[model samples]
Structures are given as C-alpha cells and as structure tokens.
Target: MSEVKLVLSYKETIQSKLDERTKELIIHAKNASQNAHAPYSSFHVGAALLLSDGEIVAGANQENAAYPSGLCAERVALFKFGFDKRDRYLVKAAVAVPQIKGENLVPPCGACLQVFAEYRAMQSTPIEIVLVNGSGKVLIAPDIYTFLPFAFTNRSFKYFI
Candidate 1:
C-alpha cells in the first residue's frame, strides 16, 4: 500500500454567484425536495445530476415504513441515472438539503458517497459535487473523491471471475 495525498479545494459561495448550469442544478434539486416523502424525519432532501448529454435528472428522498429501506436523495438520483444511462457520463451532481439553524449543509451519507465513488470510477472524467442549503449557500467540490478520501474502489478488493 502506498500513501496518497488528498487535496480538497471546496469552494463556498452564494447561489447568485454560481454559473448558469450550477444555478440551474440547485434550482432543480430544491424543487425536487418538495416531493420528498420524509414523513418520519421531516428532513426533505433532493438531488440532481447533470449528464454529459446535456440532460439533468432529479430525485427526492423517499422514506419507507421500514426505516432502513428508505433512500437518500443522492442515491435516488444517481440510481435512476445509472439504471438506464450507465454509458452517459455524470458530469456533475447537486444535492439540496434543508438548512438547519446555526449549521451548514449536510454532506451525503457514507452509502451515498460509496455509490458516488462507484459511478466516478466507471468513468474517466471526474464528477463535480455541489451541495446547497436552503439559505442559498453553496459548497462545491472539484470531485466526489474530495468528500471520500479513502473511497473503496475496484482495486481495493480482488475478485475471482
């Protein structure tokens, strides 16, 4: 095993200052949050993915009666995109979360991060991750790997195929 240096340059800015595409992604994610079925948590979340084909896919968190069966907004959108468009490159991803008072935007959970790592590994280009809060504050990471420094990849394990 070799030591790998992790470099994360997460930029913070207001929504108004973001580029058009990023702004649009945030808007879509926020709108999608309205459809979240989080009766138990009451924490609505939404996610939007920008595909290289110039299409955006959005999904809202869906809670199930069985607590563990529920899915996060990030996974909802990513799974939907991966299901049918695995070949299309995931250029960027935006996650919108309700801002907690006196707190910052919450990053995606570990499971979601792992799924993101899988998708990123499937493509040659890096996937930019944008996180936004209800206050219009935005945090931009250059790539998904910025959030998961020790993300598990195919190289992490060997398969006897």
Candidate 2:
C-alpha cells in the first residue's frame, strides 16, 4: 500500500506588493499591536479581521503573569468578532507581529489555528489569511486549510453525536 501526501500552497511577497485593501488590513493589525499588554515576553502580536460587511475588527495580545492564562492576538480578535457580530462572516484575516531587524514570520499558535478552523467551518467560506512578518514580508493563504489541512471538524465526532 502507498501512503498519500498532501501539499498546500500559499503566496509570499513583500508588503508593498499587496493591494490597498490588504495593506490596510495589515496596517490595522500593526496598529493594534501597539495596544498589546505583554509585560513579560515583550513579544506583541495583533490580528485584524475583515467582516463580510466591510468592517475591520482588531485585537492585541494580552499577556498575564499567570503563565497559560494569556491568549493570543488571533483569538482575541476572533472572540470579539464572534460575540459582537455573529451575523457577519469573516472575509479575511491578518496577523501582524512587531517589526524587527530580520524577516521573522510568526504564525499563529495551534490553539488559534483550531479556532480559525472552527470559524471557517461555521462560515462555510474561505477566509483569506494574510501573515505579515517583522520585516514587511507577507504570506497569503487562500484559506485555513493551507495551514491546518487535517484540522478536526464536527464530522470527527459524528459517531458520538
């Protein structure tokens, strides 16, 4: 028997190569990073979501001294979006980390990836993901599947349900 392999595709470019809307979204994420309260790690992150209604919601990381209690910027933005406007689906999302000297790209954590997968399932649409690195480089994925191809969905528990 032969094993099957999956390959995902994404686009990589400089921030200047992106369109106006995407640039604006990244900017929102960058601006949101300024509000992050990361007293311990000093590594701030921000996320911006573009809703179906053309609204942009941004959130920053809030670190806590109590270790695991801290939530990622992606989740912060996602939870707020889910709570405030359940009716509007997410069209796109951008995650930005603080600008540094090199081309350092920080992808979302596993927990944040799971949350994104859940939101993608609920929306039934592809949410474009824009990841901006510290050096103005960008990565664009058509959907969450590019990052988490085997993400757990409700179907995984079909037998129990």
* Cα lDDT computed for each candidate against the true fold: 0.89, 0.90
lDDT of 2 at 54: 91
Stretches of model 1 off by over 4 angstroms after superposition: 1-5, 99-103, 158-161
Model 2 lDDT per residue over 69-141, tens place:
9899999999999899899999999999966536668888899999999999888899899999778988899
Q: How many collisions between residues are there in candidate 2?
A: 0
TM-score, cand. 1: 0.91
- How many clashes does the backbone of model 1 have? 0
Each candidate's TM vs. the true structure? 0.91, 0.94
Alpha carbon RMSD to native, model 2: 1.3
